[model samples]
Every structure is written in structure tokens, then in C-alpha cells.
Target: MTESVQAWFFLLLAFVGGVSAAAFSFRLLGYLAVSLRRPRDLRRRYGAWAVVTGPTSGIGRSVALKLARKGLNLVLLDLSAANLQETSDMIRSRHGVKTRTVVFDLSLVGTPQGDDSMRRLRAAIDGLDVGVLVNNAGVARPSVAYLHEADVELWVRMLKVNLWALTEVTAAVLPGMVERGRGAVLNMGSASSEAIPSFPLNTIYASTKRYVAKFSRSLYVEYRNKGIDVQCQVTHNQPISRPAFKFHQQE
Candidate 1:
């Protein structure tokens, strides 16, 4: 082969490698920045109170604790009243931050029971300065059956809980934030949606998370000028080296 051909081949290879490296570097730095930022910034910029859903376990519980440590009062929501009480007590005891619990079941979106829960939630935060909202309550079908294998009811229930519930809860808190003109809204998204080429068995879950990403982007554009910072955190259940505070709109 001619030297000119060899030179062009190496140049193309170098260009591709450089682009890939830069993309990865930016992603790593993004994670590092989120892990390093002080949590107190949320309270200082937004308000004194924050609301977190599904605070009884997992990432929700972690986020609740982090916000509490930042000296923000917490409103905890979960399906189990006992679990909510337990988490609320722990937060209060550990951080000495005021904590309130509301039994919230995101799955019952269209039912009387869910409506009652919404009413209670509204009452709980009535007339309070709620500035940070973490919409973390989500559910995935327990089994890994293919879409056709599962009953239609199962997918419908997942939709209600994962997508509709988050939207309803956000709408509930967002107006209050708008009136106050300063707030931060964080939505829990999934890595299966945009990060991967395909998610075989978890189709509905991935679709709902894609919805979350789009919803968050629209909210960011609509409300950023109004002093609201909307962020969608695309996360995976797999372990990671850094904290899961990574957000789409932060950088």
C-alpha cells in the first residue's frame, strides 16, 4: 500500500480513538463532579424542605438521608406506613432534621385509595416551603417474563406506578414550587432506556424511563427560566464506584 494510504488510515483511526476517549472522559468527569458537589447546595439554593418518594429503601432512602444531612426537613412517602415511620424516625434521630411520613402507593393511580393518598400528601405539605422534590417511587414487574408471556394487567400496573404516578406526584408538588419561584425537581430515570442498544425483557420499564427523560427535558426548558432546575437521573441497579447523584442537566 502507498504511504499516503497508510497515513490516512492511521489518521482516521486516531480521529475515532480521540473522539471515543473524549466522550468517556467527559462522562467520568460528570460523575466525579456530582459526587463531589456539596449536598447543602440543594437546600441553600432551593428551600428548607424537600420531598422524597419511596424513602423506605434503596436509592430513595439514600437520597432522603443525603438531603436530611444537608439540614433540610423531609417529607417521606412510601407504600408501607410502618416502613415510612421507621425511615422517618431514623432520619430524625440521625440528623435531627424534622421528618414527616405519608403512606403513598403510586400503583393505585386511578383508584379511590390512591386519590385518598394524594389528598393526604397534599395536606401534609400544605403551606410549607417544599423546594426539592425527588420522584423516586418506581416499580418493575417481579418476573422477567417476555412481554407476551406476562398478563396485560401486569404491564398496565407497571405503567401506572412507574410513569403515571411520577407524573401525578410531580404535578402535585410543582405548582407549589412555581408559586415560590425557586425549586429543584429530580426524576429517577433508568439506564435501560437510552444508555443501551436494547433491553430484551424489560421493555415497558425501558419505555417508561424514556418517557421520564423526555418529561424532564421539557420541564427543564419550560421551568428553568422560572427558577426551577429539573434533572433526570438515568441510573442502573448495578454497582458503581461513585454516588448516584449524576443528573442530565447539571453539567
Candidate 2:
């Protein structure tokens, strides 16, 4: 290649590298800014006790650690023993906050095991006023050819985990918060609930999330006067480290 062509290539590579470095630096700075501000913000806020379902990883795990660092004792719930123990250990060693792990599948309905699981959780956290409830335990079923082709059992399981289990666990902790006259309920929702144009393949999962949004909103309105705060966040993007599955909107 000619020297001019080589110089041009080198310049182009250098320009691309500079742009990439600048973007990364910007993100790092933004993260640092947020980190610096968070402690001051939490200092102004009262510490609260929290229960986080699906606290083993992803958004649930991040929220648990953040809240724990902000002085909230956590009750971590997940079906996986390894993930649950890892999260508990991280909270204890890093944040020095109390951590409890409960392993229970949220999909089975009207089961003795489910009821017993809740009872044990209540007993373990006995007397600690749970001021925050993060209902994040949800399961997603893979799409078949279409909504009709989706397994009926999968649909039912999704309802059990996303809707029924969320309700049961929230109900278990909420009464105490109401009695104490202060608490927050954060329910994980989805853009699919707002009728987003995701594939209809996941219709059942979307419908269950819609019910969660509606139920959470109604509970918020109903219990606001009793000093309960209910906030529903519609989560859309999963991290790149996870699988890249997309769904179109349902009819």
C-alpha cells in the first residue's frame, strides 16, 4: 500500500480509538457522579427494611445490594441455593446488613410448600418492620410458533409466578407495613403491559405483567391513605450478558 493510504488508515484507526475511549470515559464519569450523589441522598433519607424476590441476580440482585448499602436489612428470595447464598454473603460482607435467604419456587399455586415457605420467611424476619417490598420474582416461557401453540401449562406457570406469587408474597409483608403506617411497594412491570409491539409469542407473560401493573396501582391508590407507597416500574431492556430474546406485541 502507498504511504498516503497507510497514513490515512492509521489516522482512521486512531480517530476510532479516541472516540471509543471518550465514550467509555464519559460513562465511567457518569457512574462516579451517581455513586457520589447516592450516599448523600440516602443520608437525607430514612433507612428501611426490604424484601426482594429474585434477589439472586440481575436487577433484583443489584437493587438488594444498593438498598443494603443504604442501611436496609434485606430478606433475599430466590429458588437457586447457590445464587441466594452468594447474594447473602455479599450483603453481609460488603454492606454489613442483615441478610436472610429463602429458597422457594413462586410458580406453584395452592401448595403446602408455598404456604410453608411464606410462613418460614415471616418467622425468620419476625418483629422487623419490613418497610420496602420488591416483588421481582417472575418467570418467562419461551414462545412457540404462536400464542395458540404456546403450552397451556407454561401460561399457567407464568401466571402463578408473575401474578399470583407476587401478590401472595406482597400480602404477607404489607399488613405489617400498613400497621406501622410507612412502607414502599415496588412491583416489576413491563412495557409489554402497556401494549408494546413485542412478539405475540409471549402474550401470556405480558398479560400477567399487565395484571401486576393494574393490581399494584389499585393497591397503591387503596393504601396510600394508610401510608403505603406503591410504585410500578415497567422494565424493558435486559442486560447484554443475558440471552437476546425479543417478543412482538400481542393482538
Candidate 3:
């Protein structure tokens, strides 16, 4: 082609590309603006007695603090005694709300009565009405780069903690919530469950989170009319990761 003709063709292509880019940028900016302007109050119509697992740090800590400030009695659980105590102290001192701590390994798949550590946890706090249950205890591992490098038992244990333990505790508290005809179950799930990524090693952990999200949604559909609110928080951004924090389903 002639130089003049080629130059004109390239110019046209650049113009189209610029227009497309500008359109995308405008849309993104508008979305961000709307998100920034929206109100974020929890909007609870009734009071609660909240239970938060993995309340030692990060999102769990924030959730616990928020509930405490909102005047909800808090039950904070973690495997770390120091962290659990710290959370309890913060809530009691700062918010002046009632706070209880249970430092037992919840990754084990049963009630506290079945295990000595858990029994102590139960014995410490009993005959109380728990209105909101936050099943937020979870972990990912020592970087299993290869399938063979992964410990099958450890993987199962993680599932037992992430899935089964949460289930048991919720089971223990659920009947009460139903009997009262009002309560909330907040499950901390991961966004990896929604869009399956190609990352190796984190597959099993991710799958467990996916199960949590699915379970929470299914429960909501079944029980929302009964005045029960089941909220699953699927977080995309974590403290250790480079992504932004968001929930798949937020109400």
C-alpha cells in the first residue's frame, strides 16, 4: 500500500482503540463512584448475641469489633489463647459489651463435649442465648506446589475445621435461633469459590470455601421467610493476598 494510505489506516485504528479505551475507563469510574457513595450500615432490625470464630485477626477481628460496638454480646473463639483474650479484653473494655473467649482447636469436627479442650470451652459458657453465629475460622497451608507435596491428612483436617467444625457449632446454636424465630449465620467464605482459578495447591481449601458459600445461600433460601438471615461473606481480598476485599453475596 502507499505510505499515505497506510498512515491513514493506522490513524483510524488508533482512533477506534482510543474510543474503546475511553468507554471502558468511563464505565469503571462510574462503578467506583457509585460504590464509594453507597451506605454500608449492617441495618439489623433486631439485637443479637454474636459468636465469632477466628476472631483473633483481620476480617474476623473487624467483624467482632463491629458487632460489639453495635451492642451485641460477643463470643470470640480461636485456637490462640492470647489472641482470644486480647479480643475479649478489647470488646469488654472498649465497647463495654459482654465478651466470652473459647480457645480450642475448632478444626476438629465435633462439639466441645466430645473433646476435653472443647468441653472446657462449653463449660466456660453455657445457658446463654447466641443470636448471631459467625463461622469464620479457616486456614490455607504451607504452599503445596505439587499434588504429591500435599499432605492428604492435613488437607482433610483443614476441611474438618473449615467445614465440619463450623457446621457443628452452628448446629448447636441453630435450634435456639429457630426457636426464637430470628437470628443470623455469617459464614466467611472466599471468592476463589465463585470463579475457579488455575492456582495449584489451594484447590482443596478453595473447594471448602465454595461449599460454605453454597451452603449459606441454600440455607437463606430455605429459611429467610422464617425471619432467619443466613449471610455468607465470600472475601476476595485477604491480608496476605493482592486482591481487593469483596463479598459474593451481600445483603
- Over 4 Å off in model 3, which ranges? 1-46, 111-126, 142-144, 236-251
Worst 10-residue lDDT window, candidate 3: 237-246
Candidate 2: where are CA atoms >4 Å away?
Answer: 1-47, 195-199, 236-251
Full-model lDDT for every candidate: 0.82, 0.74, 0.71
| Candidate 3 C-alpha lDDT tens digits along 143-211 | 564657788778777888878887777776676677777777878777677656655667777788777
TM-score of each: 0.86, 0.74, 0.72
For model 2, where is the 10-residue window of minimal lDDT? 240-249
Ranking by TM-score: 1, 2, 3
List RMSD in Å for every model shown.
Answer: 4.3, 9.8, 6.0
Best by TM-score: 1
lDDT string for model 2 (1-251, tens) is: 99999999999999999999999999899667755652332212322578899988777877787787778889888888898998899889998888888888887645898888888778866787678788877887744447777777877788889888998888889878777877778787787767475547677877887888788778877887887777676654321111111111111
- Measured with C-alpha atoms, the lDDT of residue 239 in candidate 3 is 21
What is the C-alpha lDDT profile of model 1 across 120-176, one tens digit per residue?
999999988999999888877844778888888888988998899898889999998
Q: In lDDT terms, which candidate is top?
A: 1
Minimum summed lDDT over a 10-residue window in model 1 is located at: 242-251
Q: Give stretches of model 1 more than 4 Å off.
A: 17-40, 236-251
